[model samples]
Target chain A: SQTIHQWPATLVQPVGSPLSLECTVEGTSNPNLYWYRQAAGRGLQLLFYSIGIDQISSEVPQNLSASRPQDRQFILSSKKLLLSDSGFYLCAWSVQSYTEAFFGQGTRLTVV
Target chain B: TQLLEQSPQFLSIQEGENLTVYCNSSSVFSSLQWYRQEPGEGPVLLVTVVTGGEVKKLKRLTFQFGDARKDSSLHITAAQPGDTGLYLCAGKNGSSNTGKLIFGQGTTLQVKP
Candidate 1:
């Protein structure tokens, strides 16, 4: 079975501070990885998706960026955090296109 | 851009009651999926409907995909408090192969015990 791990489970960062959230998948290779953010009372919004290492497609222009360093390791980063950046960040992986995505426990980020 | 609209953004019903939530879209989809999310957790896949006019049942939950593949619905029979959560509908565009998805705003359901 495949599992996704994300950390830190909860984060409190000061405004303008750097941010790094890591997600890794085990038991699968060359899986599609995605980054999503869910604001309070809002649906999950796709931030970035990667088909392969170094191939990332961003859905929206924002303060965040994503990178896939390895086949199953994805990272979401930001040089400076904004108050609006606070939300629940999720990492998901899928075996192929148009397939069901398995998600991690998620990271709750609060920028104060 | 393709958009999915879900109705009854917030629903509160008593236990053992039946309720239905609808997801609508103008664009056709190759596949549609429904997910349930609880507080502090990622959304979990409940069911997937692929063919047009598809009806799938998972326990007491019934899911139906529209005949045109442009809409879907989730009906719960004798809901339980454990069923309370955010219900989301997501679709894969008919032309995309990157596994990209368009998601509905989501419906929040609270089943009171």
Candidate 2:
């Protein structure tokens, strides 16, 4: 069984502070990874996706970046956090591009 | 701009009632997926419709894809309080295999007991 783990179930950070959110997958190899952010009770917005290590694509221009250092590990980081960066961040993995994705518990970040 | 438009952003119905949620888009999708999300949690996959005019059923839930492959719907029969949650529709572009998904605004369903 494949599972995803995202740390810091909740976070509160001050503006201009550095941010780092980590996600890792177990029981799978070379799976497609994705980062998504959702507003309160709304749909998710794709932030970044990686097919493999060193290969990442950004869906929108924003105050964030993603890195895939290992096959099953993805990290989302920001140099300076903003108030608008507060949201529910989710990490997911899939066997293929068009397959069902399994998600983590998610991290809720509140930028103060 | 939102590529997919979901209707009835909020719905409240009684148990045993039936309801339908619609997700429409102008662009073609190779696959359309439906997910249900609870507060403070990640969305869970309910169904994925790939072929045009495809229909699939899961217990009391029925999923239908538009004939044009640009829209989809979810119908729940005899809605229960357990069915209350936020529903989201996502689409994968047919033109590319990037695997990136575009999501709709989402519909919040509340089934009152």
Candidate 3:
């Protein structure tokens, strides 16, 4: 079965600090990857998605950026974190154009 | 702007009670999906409705797609405590939209003993 992994299950960061969240899939190659931010008691907002290596699309203009450094690896990064950037970050992967996307464990970042 | 609007942002009921949550959209969708998410976890797919006017049931949960493909509903019969979670409805509009999803503000459900 395919599984997705994300690092730093939880983090407490200071405002203006750098942020990097990593997501990797062990069983799939060339999968469509997505990054989403979910605030407490709120809905998931699409931040970015990548169809292939180095192909990234931004849905909402935010401090966050995403990259597909490897076929099975996706990274979400920020040069400087804002308190507004604090939220639950989720990474998902799908196989085809229109299919089910499996989600990783998710990273909860709380900016103080 | 939120493309999909979910009704009853919060709901609390006793076990064995029945309830329905709605997801409405102005734009037409090719497919609509329902998901259940527990606290501190990612949403899990419950069901997907593709055909217009289609209805699919999973145990106590019944999912319905609008005939015009603009909305969907989830009905739960004889709910249980295990059903307590956040329910989210998402969809992809026709060919113009790929796999990208427009999600509804989730409805948080609490079922007590």
Candidate 4:
């Protein structure tokens, strides 16, 4: 079975610091990747998605950016993190854009 | 932009009780999906409703889509503590079924034993 992996299960960063969250998929090649964020006990908001290597589409303009350097590796980065950047960041992958996406364990970020 | 409005943002009930969560919208969709997420895990696919007014059942869970293709609902029969989680509904954004989904606000269900 295919699985998605995310790093830094928990993170605490000060304001104006940099941020990086990595997500990778194993056992699946050329899968569609996505990034989603959710506030505590709230709904999920689409942040970014990638179709293939070097192809990234951002939905919300914020202090975050995404990049797909490899077929199954996606990285979310930010040079300067804002207080609003604090949330649960999730990474997901699907067989294609329209299919059911498999999600990773997620990264919990807290900015002070 | 497509927006999904889910009702009953939070529900706390006893085990064995029946409940329903609704997802409504003015925009029509080609497909709608149901997902359940635990406290710290990712959302797991429960079922997907495609045709208008379509109904699908999964053991104790029943899912239905609106006839207008603009809404959906999830009904649980004799809910259990194991069914406690955040329920979310998602659908194809627009004409293209090959794009990111627009997710509902989600319903947080808490079933006590």
Expressed as tens digits, the lDDT of each residue in A1-112 for candidate 1 is 8899999999999999999999999998899999999987668899999999999999999999999989999999999999999999999998867568888989999999
What is every candidate's C-alpha DockQ against the true complex, given to 2 decimals? 0.76, 0.70, 0.61, 0.67
Q: Determine which window of 10 residues in candidate 4 chain A has minimal summed lDDT.
A: A94-103
Q: Is candidate 1 or candidate 4 better by TM-score?
A: 1
Quality class of the docking in candidate 1, CAPRI style: medium
lDDT of 3 by residue, A1-112 (tens): 7889998899999999999999998877778888988877667898998888998999989898898989889999999999998889999887857756678878999999
lDDT at residue A14 of model 2 (Cα atoms): 100
Q: What's model 2's lDDT at B90?
A: 91
lDDT at A88 for candidate 3?
A: 96
Query: How well does candidate 1 reproduce the true complex, by DockQ?
Result: 0.76
Give the alpha carbon lDDT tens digit for every residue of A37-58 in model 4: 9988777898998888998988
- lDDT by residue (A1-112, candidate 2, tens digit) is 8889998899999999999999999998989999999998888899999999999999899999999999999999999999999999999988866657778889999999
DockQ of model 4, rounded to 2 decimals:
0.67
Q: Which parts of model 1 are misplaced by more than 4 Å?
A: none
Deviation from truth (RMSD, Å), model 3: 1.2
lDDT of 2 by residue, B1-113 (tens): 43999999999999999999999998888999999999988889999999999999999999999999999999999999999999999998876565778889899999999
Cα misplacement distance, residue B53 of candidate 2 (Å): 1.2
Every candidate's fraction of true contacts kept comes to 0.66, 0.59, 0.38, 0.59
Best candidate (score: DockQ)? 1
What are the runs in model 3 whose C-alpha is more than 4 Å off?
none
